[model samples]
Target: MENTTTLGCLVLLCIFITFPRTKGACRFRRFGIDCRYSCNCPGGCNDVNGVCRGPCYPGWHSGNGTVCQTKNIAYNGSTKQSSNYYTFKYLSNKAVDGNRDQNIYDGSCSHTGLNKTSASWQVNIEPPTQIYQVKMYYRQDLRKRFRRFTLYLNDVDEEWRVCYHHQKDSIQSIVNVNCNITTKTKALFVYNERGTPETSGQSYERHAYMELCEVEVYVCSKGTYGDCRQFCYCKDGPCDFITGQCPGSGLCENGFTGQHCQTDCSSIGKYGVNCSESCSASHCFNRQMCHRVTGRCLDGCQDGWIEPTCVKHTQVVPCHLSVKVNSDATELCIRSL
Candidate 1:
């Protein structure tokens, strides 16, 4: 009998080893029942599902990692600059009015005073966002005026960080600069100072000017990536706005778990970090009444269970009867300690 049992176990092990489950031949960024869906996220997708396996690309919402929407956050911000060419025209807000007419006189581009030693244009973004990219549209006819410029980002701390610096004298009409680091910032700046070339010996004879036609700031929502549709519960601060990469562990809310915090703890009668605590111990009236975050019973504990946490059994203590006589009243009470 022992020999037969050992042989049966060996045969089952051999069969399991011979036919291991496979994820199939889906290529990177491809998923779905038949591996026919293409993911918008660069990180690809799980072999069995079309959801994004990683962060979605900027401007693409991570709704299953396949929705695309380009949102320009700068359009709603207030704009300002050091100086303007004319009081009635070339206002700073012109650069963010959702226009790219390129013609400065048409009230579309923002122009700083010529011969100024320093010039700057800035926008205060409403509802500070996690920004990743900035797009600048310069005057098409005078592209050289936008050369040797620096892009800056200011966070809630009011500290300015350099996003990009143009070192060349020749620039294109439209330039896109990647901040490289995603940040929860509130302001964007275009600054230029005369006589200081980004690279030594570069052109510095011309005074600085901020003649910008339009500025578009691209951002992913806080704690989200791609079209800013997914939620990422990072243990530390916010995750990378464009990549969905957390600075710390992939932590979830008390009632949630999984790499993206998508799985609810109640699914497994568990709660708390990683769903390691069992809800069954809560002694709730109904198993679903246990609070996932606090482990407290919502509808009250069952008979013989304690209040609040309901985890402990009620301790029955002996009660002593006490009698008191007053001038006009008699009282009897039972107390337990």
Candidate 2:
């Protein structure tokens, strides 16, 4: 009877281990067996395995895509601001050092000069990786210092797209924004437009300042969309990060045709934009063969045909008759070809 009871207990334990009781679902940023582990991952974490829902936060890496470890992508990047406040102690690189200390005196935040019409901060991510999201931690004591600020993505010197904008006067100490850009860029800007409006006409209210505590820029190590598991195969630039489709209003690259710009124009003896210009139709000399880029005839034009493009007929001189007046005698001379 004791042996029988032991066998029944083993069966009961197996069932209990196989089916643990469900206690609702774990909230965002929390994961574990009992939902106890917590980390400030921007894309959240999986409830079952504690892996990051997206890529690990900037300045962080996941060896197994589950544990967030020390690897500073943002800290390695360079930073600069419009102006430094007071002294050089409050440098722009402090914001990206992976420190969240709100105290500027603690050497973890960035500050700009006072009474400025506009203020800006920019970070240069070397090698130009895909920017999934940006999170800014502002100084809580002086939240008013940051108003009407905007986030922009830059390629070299040009601002290609706007990541986010703050329209309200009142904001929290921390702000998170998703960029969702198709192509990768090298720079990012946190800018305040020129001439801030004054609420009470105070001198401080007429200007803007950049007082950032910490800045986090998230990027996937590999894929772009949907938990960073899928990849894009576009010929030029990149496809939409989320949709995995070609960007730029359905426009394809030169010498390529189709929605994804995958088909080669040379396969059909065609060239130019969208492969609309055909080499055969252009009268190429080498059996309608042409260069894919310039659409020029490879072996020159056929007999009596133009050299380039081979589309026009060669001009031919017609027979002519010339009439001349002699100065010595009052006689007319006619010369025939």
Candidate 3:
């Protein structure tokens, strides 16, 4: 009886170890999944019920589920420079009155009336380094005269030491100014200074109406300190100075077409490099692929022949022999020879 009781107790212990009671089983209330052990949450820890938790890092924002995206800030008002930058215009005169020319340089001596006033705009910028460049487009009217204008960096107090002044009749000048800022600056100010009073009794008022057509500020990377050539390379794309790839779509200017866009059709097949020579029927009798670089055919064909390839030929063919007509006053005689 004692041996049977011990055997029964052993059997009960084995059953309990193999198949435990289902009560108190840890159930993942959020995912609707049950586990024998404590639920080790996957991915991010569940902060609240039915939702995962994560944070967007710097320069990026959390967009919906588990996705981070870079924030796109407007550079220019309406003009789009690229996916990264924008180009916008800041006019001196917003009233649309003809008193102010849109292209005139602001804060210049020659700008008359209310057009002489100067304005500044702010932009959010990101640079790879502390040194950057600012580009401005300016033009003066033929009658206007200007001495110098001051460009302020970041604030009206911190101004560029160099004064940009142009003589009369200097129209449409593009100026690139380099700036180094120790502190973060988001605003730029432009000041106009008139040199002397005009003969009309009105002060020149610096007739310098300035227009900010486009401004590009890029941070310089290492090994490119004070080197304009290095500045040319630190563009949006990889530098290809030999091909001038930084400005355009990796293509050369003019009517050229190629990878580097260096080949000009007008400059090919000419006396030297210009396309001047005209191919004649004797040189290129049949339809042939004329050498673009040279006005000559690779192969020549017979007079009545079409092409060396002969993929297709003209249906009309001229006979080799012709009929001879005999000279007669009344009767006419003709024979094929």
Candidate 4:
């Protein structure tokens, strides 16, 4: 019994020692009535990339370089992918490292050198970013590579949707290819492969390769960029970078979202940024304290409202050929004379 007790104590001690050093997620009131996640940690917090999250201290605070720095998702790896072959697979992902400069002496790590023209490079960005453009700095030493290329962005369906394609006529030097896309994507792809129009028109075109010295991907600002259904902002108020919400109702102190919460939460069934959430009220009609979504019904249909759409159901022309439509169908009404 003593031996068992000792072993149990040791196990407990090991667990305590090995646990990740993170405080439990906490929430507390802001200005006495508002609640918010505690960003004012003693040390620091991990961000979306699982690294130390940073920015400020508390109440218009100060910091090193962590503040004013948002996300640079191009270099971060968070996608699930497998490639048959990527040019210069020896040391991949050197292009998106935010370093576009080249070294003449040591040209090895400066770029990718794929032998097969069919090679490709891909990366996933997680949390679907709103991309606008991609800038590529091809290898200057080679000077002739990546003239013809294609860039793709992933859709909500996770497909490698082609957004832009480039075809160059001459062998330009020190030229940066800028492709404008402006779409939401979780995956990004770059290639100089088959099916993308061979420039030389030679059979050797099949053996073409690519050397990307650097690549810069730009995303649309969530507050004012693409997929922002509609946002609300008073005077020139900015929005939250992470949530795309503006701060505060033009009057309420809870803070706004989407274009500074300028996005209307007035939808009958949805609310929040881009109206992404369902209402919390069970029956909007019965008014049993609805969800954070202003108009959504948490419970079943209340009074005359229906599921999903929390608005009062008024009789209207049926859209489908169902029993309701048949009952209301008249020869003249069907013919629309």
Root-mean-square deviation (CA) per prediction: 17.9, 26.5, 29.4, 20.7
TM-score (C-alpha, index-matched) for candidate 2? 0.48
- lDDT agreement of model 4 with the native: 0.46
lDDT of 1 by residue, 78-193 (tens): 98999979564888888887777987767788888877878999998888776777889998888877777899999888889898998876789999988864567888888987
Q: Show where candidate 1 strays beyond 4 Å.
A: 1-69, 181-183, 196-205, 222-224, 227-240, 246-337
Candidate 2 local lDDT, 119-238, one digit each (tens):
999888787766776778998788766767889887655666887888875788888888767567788889974464544334236777898988877654321334434333344555
Full candidate order by lDDT, most accurate first = 1, 2, 4, 3
lDDT score of residue 252 within candidate 3: 34
- Tell me each candidate's TM-score: 0.51, 0.48, 0.28, 0.41
TM-score of 3: 0.28
Best by the TM-score measure: 1
lDDT of 4 at 335: 23
Query: Which candidate would rank higher by TM-score, 1 or 2?
Result: 1
Candidate 3 per-residue lDDT, tens place, 1-337, comes to 9999999999879856644432233345222111222112243323222122454322222323432212222133222111111122233322112122334344321122333433233343333123245544444343233224455554334434332334443334455666545444344444554433553236355334433333444332221123312212222343332223444454333323344333433234221133234333323443333333333343444443344322222333235444342332122234446
Q: Where is model 3 more than 4 Å wrong at Cα?
A: 1-74, 77-131, 140-147, 155-172, 180-184, 195-208, 221-337
> Residue by residue across 1-337, what tens digits does model 4's lDDT show?
9999999999879855643222233233111111112223244543311122444332212223322122345654532222323433424465555556654234422333434546566667767766654556666666555556677777777567776666754455344434344456778777666443455564334455555555555432223322222233433354534345444543321222343444334323445444555454334654543333334443446654454445444344434444342332232223233
For candidate 4, what is the TM-score?
0.41
Locate the minimum summed-lDDT window of 10 residues in model 2.
325-334
Identify the superior model by TM-score, candidate 1 or candidate 4.
Answer: 1
